[model samples]
Target: MLNRKSFGFDWGQFITGILFLIAAFVVMRYPLATLKTVTFIFAVVAIIRGIAILAGYSTLRQLTGKLAWVSLLMGIFDLVIGV
Candidate 1:
């Protein structure tokens, strides 16, 4: 039975998977490298994502919407964890 409803996948998952692979390889290969560099990148990413989520909240009217809420929560969580 084909319902009228539909679901979509996010491109972010693929990008994140690729990034994780790259990060793992880089970290493994350069274990002796400065930790500050990795921490800096993590911080930058978290900050940027947090800002993006905050901006999106204005356009996201429905708190029940999964994408809106998930994005906002993930952004805040990432920022906290990153810091």
Candidate 2:
């Protein structure tokens, strides 16, 4: 039998999603005012996400061997686009 841990709520991801929703709502509410701000925010988010993916390279590699390199490359692309 496969060993599986109990499924549980991930509060951190949930809270982060909620915060992103709130920010999106605020940006949508004042589109004109937040136009540039939203772009900057997205760029920063992309950069952070890229860094996070890169940081988890080892775990990914362990799971998928050579396939994991694709994710690493994607992360690098994201960083470049963000910058």
Candidate 3:
């Protein structure tokens, strides 16, 4: 017989997802006041995403080979847009 373990819920991911939803609601409710804040948040997220992609370039390249360049380009584009 094989021992199987059930996967547990990720509390951190759940909490962060909930927080993102609340933030979206707040932005929708008060667009004018939150416009700048929302943009800043977006820029930060883009920058972080770009960094993560670049950091994982090696693994991604191994997985996708020729297609990895597209991901790299996307990361660069994101970094540029974020800045």
Candidate 4:
């Protein structure tokens, strides 16, 4: 009696849960890699955020006055931090 729209099961969450469980097992099996693994994940996140900020520069171009300069500075800072 479960309708597709009302079924509270979110497929994406289910898949993510499974993946997280697998990751936990892997981390447990290789305790020494825990630090390196976490660092690499954070690095990737930072790099992606930096790229997003850089891309927003184009949108800021339409704005006037000091806003443009502020956007440019923020984008550059994000890129430097990521690198």
Candidate 5:
């Protein structure tokens, strides 16, 4: 016989596992769509990161001297690529 501590009905884990299984099935059936969605999210994040880096350019410059210019360019490139 199992003890209550080890064999109780864990509703939270059960629901999470079920949802994970559903996601797995969908991913298997429509891999391209999932990839596209994930890519789009990454692009949005890149754009946000670019803006963030640009906003902090002065501090970055103070810390890294001339190397900051490379970061500024990278930020601009990110914004362009994301769009």
Candidate 6:
């Protein structure tokens, strides 16, 4: 079943691919800057994940018994590492 109305160029993918190529060039030209950028992105993600885990603590507590406190600890750890 070839749907004639369902085919078109993926502009979003094209733009993303182009942007990635440019980013690769920049990274190659400036390794230190790239490292910093990547580090910052990871830290932010980790911090957000930690916060989410902490927020769901009650549910986790019910499921994991005494081990739920570990989520709290990990969340704080994420905030510290992010900062």
**lDDT score, candidate 4, position 74:** 68
What tens digits encode model 2's per-residue C-alpha lDDT throughout 1-83?
Answer: 22757756755345547657766987889878676766776676667767877887888899789899999998898798789
| Ranked candidates (TM-score, high to low) | 2, 3, 6, 5, 4, 1
- Candidate 2 lDDT (Cα, 0 to 1): 0.75
List TM-score per model, in order: 0.48, 0.71, 0.66, 0.49, 0.57, 0.59
Residue 3, model 3, lDDT = 66
Colliding pairs, model 4? none
Q: In model 3, which runs have C-alpha deviations exceeding 4 angstroms? A: 1-19, 25-31
The models' CA-based lDDT, in order, is: 0.64, 0.75, 0.74, 0.62, 0.72, 0.72
The segments of candidate 4 whose C-alpha lies over 4 angstroms from its true place after superposition are 1-30
lDDT (0-100) at residue 72 of candidate 3? 96
**Per-residue accuracy of model 4 over 1-83 as CA lDDT, tens digit each:** 33445745654345545555665776899899977765554455455555665676676566455577777776677667656
Error of 4 at 55 (Å): 0.9
The TM-score measured for candidate 5 stands at 0.57
Cα deviation of 75, candidate 4, in Å: 2.7
Badly placed stretches (over 4 Å) of model 1 are: 1-17, 62-83
The digit string of per-residue lDDT tens for model 3 on 1-83 reads: 22648656755345546656766987989887687767776676677767777887888899779989988998899899889
Q: Counting only residues 3 or more apart in sequence or on different chains, how many pairs clash (N, Cα, C under 3 Å) in candidate 5? A: 0
Task: Please write out the lDDT profile of model 6 over residues 1-83, one tens digit for every residue.
Answer: 44567766755345545655666776888887997765755566666666776777888888779998888898889888878
> For candidate 5, which ten residues in a row score worst on lDDT?
10-19
Q: lDDT-based ranking, best first?
A: 2, 3, 5, 6, 1, 4
How many backbone clashes can be found in candidate 4?
Answer: 0
